[model samples]
Every structure is written in structure tokens, then in C-alpha cells.
Target: MAFVEPGVAAVEARQADRAKIRAVAAGRRAVVIGAGLGGLAVALRLASAGWRVTVCERYGSIGGKMNQIEEGGFRFDTGPSLITMPWVFEELFEAVGERLEDHIQMVRVAPLCRYLFDDGSRLEMTVRLPDWLASIRNFEGRDAAGFLRFLSMGAAALELSRATFFERSPWERPSMADLAALRRPLPLRTVLPYATVVERSCRDPRVRQVLNRYTTYVGSDPRRTPAMLSVIPAIEMLHGGWHIRGGLYRLVRVLGALCERHEVGIRTGAHVERILTDGNRACGVGLRGGENLPADVVVMNGDAARLPRLLGQTTASAEREADRSLSGLALLFALRGKLDGWPHHQVLFSGDYSREFDDLFERRRFPSDPTVYVNVPTRTDPSMAPEGCEIVFVMANAPANDGDLWDVSMLGEARDRMLARLDRAGLMSALSGADLVAELTPRWLADSFDMPGGAIYGANSHGPRRAFLRHPNKARRVGGLYCVGGSVHPGGGTPTVLMSARITADLIGKYERI
Candidate 1:
């Protein structure tokens, strides 16, 4: 295999040498845009492979959404509080001959999360399988066996998919074929339907709602999500969920340090205004300050939908017009005192979950009553908050952007409504008279991370086609351009994004070796 420049025009023999020179030059310089987890991982992987790698981040900090903030003696990790599949981090460290445990201390939580119902009933879902089963039995009698059966199916699906689908580059379509042929796998058709698992295993509406919420972790609705998602709980319960000693943000810091150790050049506050192109082939990137940083390969870790603007023109396969995933409306409250009744992580579902999903994904408006996720890291890590206080991240799914005009008055009213709802649901009583130290909304996330319309996950997983039709790892038309992130292959969440990075790295490594 030889290096090929993307988008080079055909020329006569007289100009062939010039084209070859440009192609070789393009193949030697690799630039990674966005210093998020995916970008950092790729930079580290490429650098370890002896490729000159440079990572550019628009924000002053390296972590994109995973960045943290300190306000009035309270510290909060602005995004992604949960950490799953600790091996992913371990792999990145091992790639550079280091151990993650040396960089960051992680503690596994027994009850990964707690769900509180409107009627004051609560269920603590633990990482211990026996404990979780007991909780299920307590909530809905005789449903424990059914839940176990559902988990078994999910485990099988996860095993099949993780080995075959999650580890390969999306650019290598035939890679999947080769793996399938080698393994002689069962078709996805053999797996149980997602809807059947929920309906059969859960008898109570609340129990069903609690189980269904897991789908949202991957940006899918449980009703529409494939039964393959059942593996999520199995992985969580069996393998366990972890909480980093300081905060989840510490993981980003550790990754950044690992990249530095590998001699990967990292540039913060340096934005790529445009991708420098030699005809259709990406040769390098032009920074915001009008400086040109040449690259042989370019990997985008930002939102895939926004790639066209950065590239300065749309490629043949750039689907910029596609509808995006639902964004979130968040309220990060730095309370002056601890939340009395709440656990480390809690989900308070609305009375009508189906209606809420429909409104956010279909009606394109903020749900009248939204299912809320409340995360208080201080419960596990006292360092996050001052003595006698806590940091709470309250989030609910909202329209990415409905083109509805937003006003300060409307936002204030919405906050009031959300606070009232929390009080009414008995999820939080501190909000009634507590002093707020910090608050963030969708607008903040958009402005800070450059996420279009503040959409968290790039696209929704609604239809079966959409689930399989996610953005590929490599540009179908542009050579030397690749994508690796939440918006790309293997889908969203901490573990999946790390998987995407690994797949992209392996592809780039193979190409370099050839």
C-alpha cells in the first residue's frame, strides 16, 4: 500500500511527479482538531507510532466538554460524570508503557445510581448483580428472573458486537466483512427485540421507565432502541461503574499528561479556521490566527455535522442537512449546603416519558415535563465541594434548536418551573431556599464547545437505519481525512468514544506502516 493524496486531479505524465510529491508530503503530517478525549487519544496513538502529531484545541483547556470549573469554593465537572469500562483508559496508558492507576485513583461505586419516583418510592441500582436483582424483586415481585433472562440476551449481543463492530474502523467497510467471515457470527435478527425486553421484564410503569432510561445513555429511546442495548446494564453491573477520586475531569487531565509524555504537541486556544487543501486532498489546516499547520493526515474530533464549514466546502457525502440529536438544558447548582435526601446519582422521571421524548425528538420543543437527571459528585468525592456543601448537576433533555426565540424572561420562568417540579417530585428540597452559586444552560454548552445548536450527541438513534447510518471513521471521498468522536463510529458515551479513538488510531497506524 502507498500513500495517496485525497482529491488530487488527474494529470498528464509531465505533472505526475509533482502530484506524487504533494501526496507524500500530505501523508507525513498528521493534525488532530479538537483536544477532546477522541482527539487526545488519536494524538497519543499516532505519536507513539512515530508519526509527528499535533492537536489543536479552541478552548484554553484541553478537555472539550469534560472540562471542569470552580465557583465559590464548589468544583464541578461540567460534562460526563460517569466513567465505564476502565480498561479503555488503561489501554491508552499501556500504549505508552504507563499504568492509569499511577495517574488517577478510581473507586468503584456499589449502587451506581438511584431512581426516585414522584410518589416518594426509590430504587437503588447497584453494581452488584445480586443486590441489583434484589432491588428489582423488591420493586416488582417475581420479575427478577425475567430481568436476568433479558440481561443474558443483552450480554450475548454486547459480546458479539463488541468483538466485531466496536473495534474496527468505520472507514474499513470490508474489515467488518472479514471479521464476520472469520468468526462465523449470528445475525442481529437472532437477538431479542428491545421492546420485548422492557415489556416482559418490567411490570410496574416506574420500573419500566427506570430500565428504559438506559437507552438514552447512547442517545436512543428504549422503545425504539435495539435489544443490543441491554448489554449496557450487564456491563455496568458485572464489570462495575467507577468514580474517579477527584472528579471525572481528572481523567481528561491524565490523558493530557499521557499525550505530553508521548511527545505529542498540544496547542490550546489554537483553533483550525479552515482545512488547507491541495485541490480535493487535505494537505494541512489554517489556524484561526492565519498560521498554516501542515499535516499528512487530518482527524476531526469535533461534531461531524460541522465538518463542512471547517473544510470551507461540502464534499459529495457531507450530509450537513441531516437532523441532529436532542440537546440538553442543564442547571449546575453550587449549593451552599448538602442535599439532604439525594444520593450520588439519581434520575427523576416525568409522569409521561413517551410524551417527553416525542416533544424533544419529534415536536421540536422543550418537553413540558422532562425526565431529570441529578448528579451530586460530592457524595462520593468531598473535594468537589466545600465543607457542608455540594455540587449538583441537574439536567433534562431539550430541543437542540427549534428556531424558537429565546428570551431572558422565558429562561427565568423555565428555571422556576424546573425547581418547582423537583420540589414536587421530592427529589430536591434544597432548591426551595438554597443560594445558587452557579448555573449553566444549553446556550453555555454551545458557546463553550462550539457544538451546533448545543446538541449533545451529534444525531439521534431513532430509526434502525439511523442507528447503522452513523458517520463513518474515514472520509468516503477525501483521503487522509478521518473522524473519531461521539458523533462518529461505535456511537456516544465515555467507553464508546474511547473505542472510536482506538479504532481510528489502529487504521491510521496501519496506513502509516503500509
Candidate 2:
């Protein structure tokens, strides 16, 4: 054959393939397994695209990890305290011809987090450059410039990622814009490990700890995480952290509403036992009680590691304990009286940050001196509590190992360690008359979400390949099967999960539609 331009030939081939896909009418069915944010968002998108959609959730309520609890007039969000990249969410509403502002209010939280160091020193981290730089100068005058340079590098990574990684799966054909982004000169820091970059960029250990904490946002260890993951902090510094008026769970409610408006059906207490396939292509699902629901396409919103079990494979494809991400132990408190002088979010650092990660990832146990994170949602929204009470959420990172049993005694020890960290920061006294409403241990996360070891974001984003080469949205060996949510491509977080849904819906439009 005579040589033709490669791009042109590829376009011709895609066009020919498109012509072969038969057009189906409006009644084509889609089954979404799980009612998490990603599942609900894709269900809304497909339903809006004229395909009938049904979402089956194993739990009685929607919002998998992004759940909520209300007791004695106090409400606490179980997962994801705040959201950044608000525009990512806005796009989803815009896609379905709805306005996000009309449905929910996004309140910007100033001084995103209050960091309490081991020596009782406190600093407020904000997006306002002048104020933050001034604070940095007070702590370590030389680090101010380094901090700016680090953030600058992160901005570049975010720019490149938006053009490529965030747009589509790695297996898909890249647009010219994506290829152009790839050609751009990358920062030297982007090639280094995240922890190494942080240590090199800051003189003070406190600042390094603050910057290093970003890696844990995706359930990764900073020492091994790739430098491109710097985008996490860059996003927060650029867009500012936001909280819905009610709670982060409000986002799930808004997504559920959008799905309902598009005529999508949501079935709770419907456990999908297996993914039913016909001749290697996903046709529907088998419920736990043996009810078979047929559909043209199936999307999994649970942990990607559980896909094989649901497909009836003899051997498990679950991530190994060494490869799994960190899980958290959370203690939700409902205080009896008013507690002032606390921000919406605070991080109490451990004396030795490196050793803490060693305990979490290597020792495979809760840290002996674990860093504790405290979030008092009532600080931002008083409506979350009673007139004089507040809801306090205290959490610490723990290993996501399957064999570990977080029994009552184990939970008590973890709680004590967490409270001790808070006490050192002088915030524990406020909980003198508090009620411990609930505790979410790693075992609870594993059992409740069907996640292996309760690995929140599936595999840890360690090396470059593992960080970027995530499970694709479309399954290669299984036709008509797709994956979405925090565990899949584009990775986790509220905004990224929504992006995953958008990408999955577009792929279905391409391969399953004419």
C-alpha cells in the first residue's frame, strides 16, 4: 500500500470502525454497580444521553465512603471533609443542563488548614500568597522563595495533566493538545521523588511535613510518591478548599438528584453478586439473591481490585497488602458544649514524620506516635450541630492489611494515641464533655465498602509507573465492561472521581454507540 500520513490513516480507520457500530434506540439499558459519586454521575450522564440507567447499591443508602451520620442533632461527614477544583464539579452540572449553584452552595474555607507542629508551633495555611509567604518568612526566611518555586513547579504539572491525564485514559488516543503538552519542557523537580523534592525545597522540617502531607491525600507515602503528585497541593493553593453548606455528602445528594432528574433509577439494598457476561461482553448483573438484571453496558464503581471476584474468577486479583494504600482510623465526637478557637481543619504532626510512614507502610501497624487530623465541621457550618454543641472528627492513618483485626481493644489503643496527639496541641481538653459518636477503623472501611483491606484509593501512588499506569476506565479483556471512581484511572479525590465518570461516559459513547 502507498504510504499515507499516519494521522490521516488512523482517523480513517476510526471512522470506518464507527460506521460498523449499530445505532440503538432510546431504550438501551445501562447498569451501574454502586451508588458512589462516580457511579451516580455516570448514571446521570448516560441517562441524559438517552440510555435508560439503573444504579444498584449494596448498601441501603447512596454515597459509598462519602457517607454521613446524624445523631442528636449533630451531623458528621464520614469521608472527604472538603473539596477543591470546584469547576470540575460545575462542569458535571453544566453537562446535564443544570446549575450547581442552584442546587447547593459551596463555601470557600479560608486558611485551608491550621498546622500544629510537634513543638506547639501553629501556622495557618492559606492560598493568599502574600499572607502565606509572610508566615513562611517568620518561620524560615529562606524557605519562602523555595516554597514559591515548588508551587510553580506544581502549577506546571497541573497544566500538563489537565491537557492529558485528566482528559482520558492512557490507552485511548491522545488529542493534539495532549501530545503538545507532552512535548513541553518538564520541571526538574517533576522527576524526583515527592519527599526528596520537599526536603530539597524547604529548610524547616515543619514546612516539609506540611508539603509532604499532600502525598497522603491520595493514600500514598511521600518518600516513594512521584513528583507529579505535587498537583494535589497546587490544586488546593490555586482553587482554595471548599465545603458544601451541609457537608461534602451534599455533593452526593446533588449527583443523586441529577440522576433522578434524568429519569435514572436508583435501587438501594441491591447487592450485585456477579457481573453477568454473554460471550465475553458484559450483559448485566446477578444480584445476591439470584435476580438477573440485563443491560447493554455495566460500570463498576467499587474498588477496581474486586473486579475479578465479581466476574467469578477462581483466583483473586486483589491488590497485595504491600501494594495497597493506607487506610484511616476515624473517631467522630459530638461535644456537649461550645468549643471555640478551632479552624475547620487542623493537622497535628507526629515528632518523626518518616517513622510514622514506616509504621503505616512497612511495619503494617498503626503508628506509635501517629499524626492526627482534626476536623470540626461546625466551625464552617453551625447547622451541622445543635445550638451549643459541635461535631469533631479525629483521624489517623493506619495500614490497610486484611489480617489486622481492629477489635474493641485495638480501637481503644488507636483512639488513645490519636487523642494524645491532639492533647499535645492543647485541643483535647475541649472534648472533656464530648460523646464519641462513631469510629471508622480500617476493618470497618474494608467490610463496608468491599474494599480489600479498605485500601481507599486502590493501589498506592508510589513509583512513576504505578502512579500513572492505573487501571484503565475500559476493561481490555472484557467487552462492554468499564470502571470508574477513586480506584480507577485519573485516580481518587472528589473532583477526580467526577472526572472519571465523565471519561467513562465518553468512552461508552465512543465504543458502545454509533
Candidate 3:
């Protein structure tokens, strides 16, 4: 659907209404920089709440990492093909008095994903708990019970963490009271200490590898990622994975339409040169082309780490230290023919998962045998491709950018190695005779998204400190400024970014009220 910009008359009327509301001390003028998912969500919510909102996007299109690339007769979603937590999107639509179902069609998948182990063993992880247990039983009989026990523990941990950790705003550090509440919960205490959820869940190395893979969803290393992340799978298993019709990028289009419906102003291709700060307060932003947009509040939907640079200031050492998260490398391909044997989602594990991660985090180099993720959207939605064609998204974790290693030679070699690895894993046979489609590398991600080091999720989800040590929503030194994105609070993923937007909007609402 084409985006319909709000009419000038409607915008003026909304402004007049907001002015009247402000006269009664009820509203504020807000500007959101970067029309990424987080920024778009925040803008929609605030506009729905009677605030005069404007969204500025540097890119020609919205979606940030969740962008769509079209070439020839093929189209591919560049980032985050999977959608979980449908309720988050529903909430946004509800805020605007629209139903999510009215705009986007979502289909829930039964077998969440199929995992191919290095030893050639395959396991299909299902959304149904019993089916998942059955798969575990098929692999290791008695271990099946242990798997169920583990999931039970994971479910409890999810509840505790979601309530205590995920719900709160990242701007305010949790006090002794918060810590005390977290400690009082048994499941939280049990899950909090482990380096990896798989460590406490199973004894088999393969099982550990399977569970450890969840850490990658947040751009984290299982060995160092908090155990609380086990809830990730718990939530997915309980709620199920969803596929949005017409690609997930349609979400951005729908949201952009919703923003217009609420009279929120959106400006595309508007690069923000610097955040305009009034002494210690951010009053607005300066455009690269010399246009200055004014507002009482500024919400940044770009990478949190880039905030200091955008503000034309050196990031504090503490701020820099707190911002280490996982970055990623992805390869999106538009194939000429269909792959018969592949599922919608597939995960291929390396022989030595631990050593592979060690190569990444410890040595800061690409792994010899990196775990590979393949997403064949055509498996579920044939319309995404030509009559018999397919769209494939291949991805793996790689070093963001260290300045010297991102040379073309290195990138080309990495791409060749990945394709070869897929061939060795039996994927190439399925796509035999299929034409080579478009290829997007980490460099493309960096160039397109303006993310430092091509990192997908801001910092690595390492220790508990990493989880709680996110960049604050409100700047510590700058007033009238806020950040909402994967680089900041609630962390990465589509759902989390949406939550970050809600949290940021709530903060803005509270600030305006005060």
C-alpha cells in the first residue's frame, strides 16, 4: 500500500487541538530522529496521545535494519525475517484505534525452526511443548524429562525476568529494592547465575549447543550471556513464531500510514547533522542540509552508541564502556528457482560451537566453522518470489568492525566460505541449478544503516551487567533528549525495539506532564 502523507489541513487541526490542550497544560511538541522501527513506534504512540509529533528519517525508506531489497523479479527482507511477540504490534495498532489484523496478516508456524547439527542429525524444534519434548526424546530418551524440567525452569525464569527486568525503564538504575525483589524470586536466582542456560539445562553437548543458540537472537555469546535469556525460547515456544504477509517490511509501511492517520509529520531522506543542544538540554536537531527542526523534546531512534557523535560530543568513557553488544553479518539472496527440501527457517550448527564463539569474541575474527541461519520466506509465502523462484536469507554472527579487517578481499572470502559451508551442509543440493541472487554483507549493513561496525544489536548481551547497563533512555548530561532503539534499553529484535518505543513514549509523556 502506498503511504498517504497527512493532509496539511489535518496537521493544522491537530496542531490547533494540541495547542488548546497545551493551553490547559496537557501536551508537548515532540520530534523523533531516525524513522527506524523504534522511532516510528514512539512517534505513533505520542501522536496518538495528542502530542504534535514529527519523524525524520535519513534513509529514503523506513524499517532501518528490517528493510526490503528488490532486484529483478525477486525481493528480500534484509533484516529480522522472523516475528515474535505479536501482542507488541497489536498494542501499537490499538493505541491508534486500529486493529493489527486489519492491516497486517500474520500466520503462526507450528515447528518453530529446524536445526541441523554438525554430525548430520536434524531436530525440529516445535512451538508445542509436547512436540518439542518428543523431539528431545527421539534424540536422547531419558534426557527428554530433563528437557521438560529445564523448560519449566525456563518458563519460571521468563516470568520473573519479564516482570522485574524487561518491564522497567533503562534510564533509572535498579535500586536495592529492585535487586532485593529479583533476589527474592527462586527461579530468577537460579537462572541468573549461569553463564549459559544450556549449562544448567542439559548434560549433552549437542543439547547445550541447541539451547546456547538462543543467545544469538540477541547478538550474545552463550558462554557469557545471562541465563535469563532462556526465556527467549520459552516465549517463542508458548506464543509461536509468526510470518507477516508481504514481508515484514510491510510493517514499516503500515506504521507509516498509521502515523499519517494520527497527523504525525514524517520527512524521509532528512539526515540529522547534529542534535541541537541548548546548554545542557536538547532543543531539537540540525539537518545535514541546514534545516533546523525545533521541538520541546527530541527522541533518537538511531543507534544509541552514535548518540554522542550525533550530538557532536565525545562519549564518556563510562558510556562507551557500557555500550558493547553483538553485531552481525547477513547474506540475502533472491534465488531463481525453488528449494524443495528446505523449511521456512533452518539453523545449521558448527562442529565446535564454543570454539567458534571463542574465535569471534576472544580473537575477534570470523570462525572457521560458524553456525549458519537460513530463512527461505518462499517456503511459507510463495508470493514473495516469482512463480517458482525463492528468496533466501543466510546469516551468521561476525565481528562488527575493527577498522582494519573490513577490506574487500576479507569480505569476499567470507562470502565464499559461507556459501561453501552451506553446500557442505546439503543446502546447495536443494538449490541445484538455482541462479545466484543478490548478496548483502556486513559492509552493506554498515553503509546502509549507519550502524558502527555493522553491529545488528548494539552491544553484546554478555554479563548481567551488559543487560542492565544499556544506554539510558534520557541522556545523563543532556535534557530534552531520549534514545529508543536496539542500541539502547529493551535491547534488540523487532518486539524489543517496539517495547523500547513504548517505554520512551511513556517517559516523554511523564516528562511533559511534569
Candidate 4:
């Protein structure tokens, strides 16, 4: 999948870009940087529209964060273990003359996740409302109805999501008429911090704590994350959670295949050093090896923080301006035995949730008592693990790659502290004998994924207007330069990233007055 290089490849690249935009244009071409999930979706969309799309990935394989790690016959998906909204993926296939059911096998994950609190009480949040109410009704009492009412509000919010709010490009500042169409009042409180809404609806302290963590999907502290993001509950509880058979990477494989099927040329090991531009319009990109790849449209699926450097222009970084989101310390283990009490997804929450966030975000230090997310993929996909062995993925929220606080030398000590948290949570005995496959730090994530500061969702979604804080889908100054990924509008997570691609691709088709 290497980009064809040397003397003539550069010449042909220039000609192809020229002919696409200038000629009869049936052979219009698109060049995509970074073949991550968003890039792959964009490529497929463009290819389906009769554009000659070329996706160049720096990684050896596609699937940026949706990477797979195999160790001692056990397989683990490094990023995004749970599939929240299946319809998003299905719609992607439907757009490209294919059906998702034909490509991937999916199994419903009942009892979506298990939440273990600091107190000895643990609650299993099921996809079915009856089962969910059965568990929480005791603590929530009459207020269980309030929780249901909150979800109804979230479902109504989805109507706005389908319109301009989520579908419209971030570059276009919405007018008063636009807000009217959304039916939101002036000076929108919908963009207010998520804590305001959660505190009003949730009666139980534990329920509020679990709901607050949903803000991490956009890599924001609960106190700062927007209330519009409350739809996360409806997305999981109503639609249900699912796991792709084989592994989550299977989706990436199918996407790559779909791109190829549509004649979208994919190149591996080609990293773009700079985006080549002709005045206001982007004409091409220059690879690290000094190779030029010209294109009519350049879709950068990389981090928005890299935009200034890639353009060779001096501009303020969206990352530096906004609070960068929290990063993670991931520990993958290959264990021979299984624990008696385990769910597909488990959250062993910290005793003091607010202090944990303060430690990570405000103090810029590791959490003294962190909420740990333990995922057992083998619960549904047994084939991922050998005979009796299981692959365990343990993730704890930590500060991003702040220059002073995090470094490789400190990773060992951090891993010990994380495992100690597990011990305190009462699951250390099961993992004590497991073989450690890898210990990854934020710096490693930064280098590996090209994330500036290794911040998971790019910018932290804080402040009064979370909408204006995120990077725009299209560059304000640079024409023909577009961005699609977790960092852009609609926020982070697999479904939203895919939605960004859909939105960006649609915007690319519209002609703007200069």
C-alpha cells in the first residue's frame, strides 16, 4: 500500500490533481491524509460519488486508534471496546451500496456494564429498562421516573442532532434563524456544562457519578462538558450495546476493503510532512521523504493540533487555546484463568470522583484514587482468547502529555499505582498471576497516534460555548483543506467520529462564495 514514488510518481500526482478539478471532472480526485476510521469513511463516500480517492496512512495498517494487540494467543482492541450506536455504522454501508449485516457479525451485549462503587454495593446497568429499574429502583425510589424522563429529553435532543447542530459544518457560524430551527432558546443553555443537568435529574449520588463519566467521551470534565451530551444514556440504554464478532478491528478491515472495492487507492508508510498550497487553496501534500502528492481536495484526518505545523503557517493551536482532554494509561494482560464475577464492561469507580478529576485536570497529576475501566472482550468473543485464556484491558484516566508531569521514567511507578487501585477494588487476586503484555503511557500514545500531548479527544469540551471551542471541520483560512476525526464537531467516540466524516464529506460538495 506504499504510495508510488520517485521521479514520475510526483509528475503524475500533479497531473491527476489538475485534470480532476480543471477537466471534464468525472475523474475528480481526492487525497486523504491518515487512513484512520474517519479517513476511511470519507474515502468511501468520495469514491462512491465518482471521485478518484487516495488515502495515505503513515501506519503499517489502517485503523488508527482501533488497533489490535495480540499477545500469547490473546487479542485485545486497544481503543473503544464498546459499540454504542450500530445504526451509524449501518448507514455508512447503506450509503455505499452495501449492507453492514453482510460484512460483520454482531452480538448484543446484555447488562451493558457493571458499576462497582467505593461502598460494597455494585450495580449492573442492563440494556432492558425493566432489568435496569429492578437494580436501581431501590436506591432511586420514585426518582427512577426522573431518570427515565431525562432519557426522553435526550431522545428529543436527537431530533436536533439530526438537523444542523450535528449535520452542519462547524465552519459556518449558525445564525439566529438556525437556532430557531433547532427550537432552542436564545443564549443556549443546551451548551451549559453537563453537571447542571445531571444534578437536577439524578437523585442517587452513585447515579450522578456514573452519568458524569459520560463526559469523558468528549474528553471533558463533567463540570465542563455540555448538557447536550446527555444523550449518551439513550444511545446505550435504548439502542443497546454490541460487540463485533472476531474483534472491533473487524470493522476497520471491512472499511478498508470497501474503500478498495470502490477503487480508492490506499498507501501505507507514507507520512505527509507538509500540506502544499497555492495561495488560499490547498493543491497537494509533501511526504516526509520529500515526495509530492497532489490532489484537488486534501482531507486531513490527523489531529487538528498538527494543522499549524502541517500548513507551515504560524497560527494558534486549538489544543493550546482550549483545555486538552485527559489521556489514558492502558495495561493489557494475557491471563490463563477466568474470574467468577466479570461482565463484558466493568467500571470500578473511585471513592472520590470529583477529587480524581481535579487531580487529573486541575492539579495535572495522576489520580490518587482513579476510576478504572476493566474490559473483558472474551465474554462475547471467546475466539479472541486461546482455550481458557483471556485478554484483559485496564484503562485509567490520567493527565495528558503535560511536559512537566508525565515522562517515560515515571510510567513504571504509575503502573504500580494503577494495579494497586485494582487491588483496593477487590479484583487484584484474579489478575495477580497474569502475564503483562504491554504498558503504554501518554507519551507513547502521542508518538504512536501523532496526538499532540496525547490528549484523547483533542481539546477538552469545557467553557460556556463548547460549540465554539472545538476545531472547525474546514479551516478558516485554508480553502480545500478539511478535517474529520474525533477532534472535530459532534465530539469524540466511534459513532461521532463517523458522523464527522459524513458531515465533512457533505460540506466538501457544497460550493462556498469566497
**Candidate No. with top TM-score:** 2
Task: Name the candidate that leads on lDDT.
Answer: 2
TM-score to native of every candidate shown: 0.88, 0.95, 0.90, 0.90
TM-score of 2: 0.95
| lDDT tens digits, residue span 331-369, model 1 | 878777767656788888787878877876667777777
List, in order, the clash count of every candidate structure.
Answer: 4, 0, 7, 1
* Tens-digit lDDT track of model 4 for 1-514: 0111223432353234333333333667689999988999988987876778889888798988888988768888988888877777876776678888889987888778999888867889987788787777777886577677767767666656654555566457765645665675322445667777778877888888888888776678888777777777777787788899989999999999989999999999999888999999898889988899888889999778788888886655355623788888899998898765688889988889999988988888778788899989897788999987788899998778548445565777778777877887789998878988987678777888898777888878787465444677887788888899988776688988888887777667653212
Q: Name model 3 segments beyond 4 Å from true.
A: 1-27, 173-184, 188-197, 318-323
Query: Tens digits of per-residue lDDT for model 3 on 187-292?
Result: 5434364444465567667777777787788877777776767777777877678889888988988998989988889998999888998888888889987999
* Candidate 1: Cα lDDT at 82: 84
Better of 1 and 2 by lDDT: 2
Rate residue 449 of model 3 by lDDT: 86
What are the RMSD figures for all models against the true structure?
7.7, 5.7, 5.9, 7.4
Task: List the pairs of residues colliding in candidate 2.
Answer: none
- lDDT tens digits by residue: candidate 2, 204-287: 999999999999999999999988998999999876888899888888888888888889999999999999999999999999
lDDT of 1 at 194: 65
TM-score of 1: 0.88
Q: Against the hidden true structure, what lDDT does model 2 obtain?
A: 0.87
Candidate 3: the clashing residue pairs are 324-459, 324-460, 325-459, 325-460, 326-459, 326-460, 327-455
